[model samples]
Target chain A: MERELKLMKGNEAIAEAAIRAGADSYFGYPITPQSEIMEYLMAQKPHERTGMVVLQAESETASINMVYGAAACGKKSMTSSSSPGVSLMQEGLSYIAGAELPCLVVNVQRGGPGLGTIQPSQADYFQTVKGGGHGDYKLITLAPSSVQEMADFVKIAFDLAFKYRNPAMILSDGAIGQMMEKVYLDPQVPRMKEEELPSWGTQGKKKGQDHKIITSLELESEKQEKVNLRIQAKYRQLEEEEVRFEAISCDDAEYIFVAYGTSARICQKAVDMARERGYKVGLFRPITLYPYPFKQLNKLADQVKGMLSVEMSAGQMVEDVRLAVNGKVKVEHFGRLGGIIHSPDEVFNALLNKIIGG
Target chain B: MDIKDIIKEENLVYKRTNVLTENIMHYCPGCGHGTVHRIIAEVIEEMGIQEETIGVAPVGCAVLAYNYFNVDMQQAAHGRAPAVATGIKRVFPEKFVFSYQGDGDLAAIGTAETIHACNRGENITMIFINNGIYGMTGGQMAPTTLEGMKSSTSPYGRDVEMMGYPLKMTELIANLPGTYYVTRQSVHTPGNVRKTKKAIRMAFENQKLKKGVSFVEVVSNCNSGWKMNPVQANKWMVDNMFPFYPLGDIKVPQDK
Candidate 1:
């Protein structure tokens, strides 16, 4: 089917794409930057047309639990919030992962340690990728830099979520969430209609069908350990098969800049600037932040002289870069904190000064 | 009667409802959870809504309630059952949705969820168990703990000036316009068991009519948590717990 290309804000694109991807329910609270998601859905009235359910929950805590309830029934459900709201959802997120439910969570991150600025920042890099919630689990995290990806990755995130029976997050930031760009949205795909609901879902199984129990509590330490080990194994598989990244000008580049999301976009501009200025600083951006692309980063580390991590936050993802590079090459970080996004010139200058002789 | 005669199929006077699982109860010998579970299971059997019922279990002693309910079940994080149940009921309005919660999970940690869910008039059932103390967490002070109640957290006896009076959550929710039927019942006696079962049945029945939230609170006993024998716990409950957390209907729909 032919798709229509529409100019959409990243937050708006997320709502539209979720509906097009056949999400059965969306429970969200009003939050800065990403509030447009629920606002868009409400105005569009997808519930009347596509039979989707859009509800403004009392809080981020309620929103995530609502998603948990519906997702436990094997439905494609989602919730979106900004950084502060995301913190409130950690408890439910932990349970959702523990119960092995499939759902989509979009975190349009703003600057934060407490109640920080309502501007774009990749400050939650460690929080989202390292499982901000309690316990040993991993969320399949995708960082979207463009409004197009903000739209496109909704379906992809839900797909990966259901495929692996794990929660998937689109780790976007306020800049991309509020920015407008051309995006092609596929036609409305009906919600997943499995011939038979997954055996794990709470769909009220009939007589003789094994009663489905969705829970994260295991009293027996031995049993809990087995479950933890099983989740760990799945994560290992994700590292091997789901590690995603984009390498720009890395084939014969001496300097490599590592970043993601909005910062990655800035690094792209820095790459162009470096090339124009007769230098060879390439950009390596990890699309999936959780899997981290360690193998790819290490291989590139063996070739490049050094790596400089450019981000909006105070050097969160840079730690991952160091771990991946493992001192194979000198790695440095430059960041504009408290929601101050660095300009292309600033990032280029940092690359020139930190990695190359200024 | 001879052994052969007594063993005849027709001679069977009672059998367990298929709605309950084979898992032996993890509850202490005198806990009210087991009886309440039986009553709910029996009601489901009589009502024939087992296949359409989805239960949200709480994070207290009955956290493993999912294992016992034969219907599809989801375990909610502490105090979020109402919100979770609201989600299920919203998505599948035709299905029977209910949340099983304890006093600590409901009145204390999850007060906001409980109020909001009811205020929205969600067509679901809420089963609240008030045992006065947190059983699974080892006799911690619950919101429903009386002013002079003694628990692990309130060892010096709850002082009204410091710890506050017991929270009457059932009476409070009765004021919410979203609630169709609100009642507080008990399961310590055979007569009370019958009444509580009736209350549970009505809660489930109202969901079929899409009649807003039906709230049922059961004042239960936790002998082990109370540090008393089963018989003494029952006596203690009737003497100390009754006046504070009285049983009977708090708010019933006019027509009903």
Candidate 2:
């Protein structure tokens, strides 16, 4: 079947894509930059269309817990929120990961330390890649650079989530979330057949071999450590097979700009501008922020003379860039904070000052 | 004459419920959790809905409640069982879904989930155990702790000014328009256990009616947390706890 093309906001694309992807349930709370997701879902009413449940939860905590419940039932479930709301979801996120349930969480991130700004920021890079909650676990994070990618990643995120039996996050921002772009919506994929889902899901015992329990608490330290190690093994496999990134013209380049999401978009323009100045610059945009493009970036470091990590925060992601670069090339950071986004020209200027200029 | 002929299988009047798991319960000797688990298991067996029931376990003394019931069960984050049950019931509406939570898990930390789930009138049963103190955390003061009652966190007794007052959560939730049935019962005595079992049955039945939320609260005793023998704790619960948390139906469906 031919899928229709639609001009949609990134957040709306997420909602529409979720329905097209046969998501069983969506739980969300309204927040700036991401409010369109719940609004679009409520207005679209997937319940009538595909028998999916759409709910406006009282809070992010309840919303995420609802996702946990639905996912534990082996249903495709998800929630969308902004920075502050995502902060509240950390507790449930940890439990979902620890319990090894598959779900999707979309964070249309805004600037923040505390209620910082409704404007976009990339400050949550460390929180996303490094376990945001207590104890160690990994979330497969997808960074969408455009509304089309935003729509496209919903299906990808859910596929990866269920395949790995772990939570997947679509880490978007205000700009990409609010921007309208042409997107090719996938034709509706049928929800998993009843028998295809895990029989261990809490759907009553009629079809399963034994009574199922979806709990995270192992109690005993030694046994809990084994659970942790099992999770680590999954992460290791993810690192090996799921590393995704966009390498833009890095061949024979002297300078490279490492970024993602909206920051990556801005870096694209800066890269073209820097190229006009004959600096041999290119952009390295990581698609999966967790199993980051560390290997590629490290190899790029050996090729490029210097690198600049551009972001929307006070250089949070640059730390990872530095760790990957490991002094092979002097990696410096350029960012705008408190809802202030750096213009492409400003980024180009920063690249000049940080990486290009002597 | 064979003795087996005198006591035939059809003549058997007493037996353990088949719905109860073979796993040995870890509840304290006198804890009401074991009593409640038995009642719930017996109800499922009697109603013949074991294949259509799902239970959500809380992060309290009955944290391993999944091991005690032979139903599809899920373990929720601390104080989030009601929310978890809401998810399950919404997804599989035909399944009988219930959340089992304790005072510290429900009244103290999960107060919002408890109230909101009831207020929204989710077609699920919430079994809240009010022991007035935290049992799993070694006797810390719970939101339902009686005034002037001493606890690990309240060494000098609960101060109204300091810790606020004991929360009558059942009374609070009963007022919500979403609730179809709300009741408080205890399981200290054989008679009360029978009554509590009836309450649980009604709650489960109401789910099929699709009327609204059914909230069954059990004002129980934590003998170990209270530093008393089980017998003394039951006596104290009747004399002190009952006066504050009177047992009876707080709300009932008009159709019923």
Candidate 3:
């Protein structure tokens, strides 16, 4: 099959890539910046083309539970929402994580502590990386900065999710979700056959097999503790092997900028502006936020004078950057809150004032 | 004849369904959940769909129902069993899927899930156990608790002015075009038990026919929650509960 290249919005790319990735079902509710994902799926009629199922649920709570149901059957299920809607899904996500079911969730983030603005923001960094709901669990978080990555990470997130038997999230923002760019969508991968499904799935019992019971409940405290230990071990493994980041011109840099998703894009341009002004500056964009590239940042901390954590929030990801650097060198945070997108020049000025001047 | 001879295969009048596991139920003594679970197991065995049936257990007293039902099961979050069942059935339409929930789960916190799932006409069966109180949470007020019904949350005989009226979820859902069959039954008596079993069998059959939602609400007695003994609870259910949640089919398929 030929690789199909087309100009598409990031949301449309997510929808198209999901169908081509052979997803079995998508359950979601309409939310700004991410509503186009379901819209594209419904308009494409993937049910006729690839036998995929698309449903618009009544609310985010319902959407995530539906994903939980389909995922329990060992199907490739997914859901997408913006900030407030994603908050509504935390309980279901916790249940899915506790049950050790594999699925994909995308959050095209908007600003919020409440019904915040529909515009782009990276305020959900703490919510996504740390345990958002009750209990100790981490989503295999992937941050996509461009529309192409928006299409590409859908397949990648699903693969990582199934490989680890854990939920994976594409932590994008409204900018990437709504922006348009050229993307080469992958060829169709066939959906998994019934025989190919994992043995743990609760898709009814095969002859001579014990009943497959998918649940997160363990009344015994000892058993629950063991479950928690096993999950922690998996997280350790992810941190050791799955930390992904991109470094641009950090080989001989005096200052460094750490960011993710939309912030990373802005910092890239800021890095260019600083280099033009004869200051050695580099941008470190983390792709996997949960298995954060802390070790890599620590190595850079030895070489750079200081680091600035840039994001569209009131300094959330900066805490992780500071932890990674661990006082080896100065680390500061620069952000624009409540749906404000900081320009490249503004980032350069912050880099000079917060990191260099300080 | 000796007892062994009386227990011979040919002389056997009743036996437990193989679809039910040998595991002991965790339900309280005289609780109706066990009987309802048995009827469902029997229906699965009779239909011979045990291999293709999936059950969703809710987060109430019957939360551990997965342990007793000898089939594939998924335990859902509080009040989200219907949404979960929708996911399973949509992905595997040929399989029979059902969600078992309680009064607090279905009629209160999960009302949106229940209403939306039924409204979408997902091809699934919903088994609702309405015992009028939150039995697992220590007999708190439930949306199905009768008027002036005293509960832990409603300490003063359920002041109607403050507590409001009990919900009739079965009749309410029956009005939706998505539901193909709706019925309210009880298991306080042997005859009623048989009728309830028949209703469950019909609900499963409706799933096979791909006829939208088939809702079976069992108005049962919760002796532990009601602060009454098993016998008194049954008598009280007959004298008080039936008048509010009368038994019988609320909807059925019309002959083509």
DockQ of each: 0.85, 0.79, 0.92
Q: Output the lDDT of residue A165, model 3.
A: 85
Q: Itemize residue pairs with steric clashes in candidate 2.
A: none
Could you tell me every candidate's TM-score relative to the true structure?
A: 0.98, 0.98, 0.99
The Cα error of candidate 3 at residue A113, in Å, is: 2.0
Docking class of 1: high
The better-scoring model by DockQ among 1 and 3 is 3
- Best model number under TM-score: 3
lDDT of 2 by residue, B179-198 (tens): 99999999999999999999
Give TM-score values for chain A, per-prediction.
0.98, 0.98, 0.99
Taking the tens digit of each residue's C-alpha lDDT, what string does model 1 give over A1-358? 9988999999999999998999999999999989999999999998887888999899999999999999998888899999999999999999999989899999999988899999988899888988899999999999998999998899989988887889999999999999999999899887666544566788886777888889998989999999999888888888888888899998889999999999989899889999998888898999999888988999999899999999898888999999999999989999999999999999988887888873
Interface RMSD of predicted model 3:
0.5
lDDT (Cα) of model 1? 0.91
Model 3 whole-model lDDT (C-alpha atoms): 0.94
DockQ of 1: 0.85
| Error at A23, model 1, angstroms | 0.4
lDDT of each: 0.91, 0.92, 0.94
Better of 2 and 3 by lDDT: 3
Instruction: Provide i-RMS per model in Å.
Output: 0.8, 1.1, 0.5
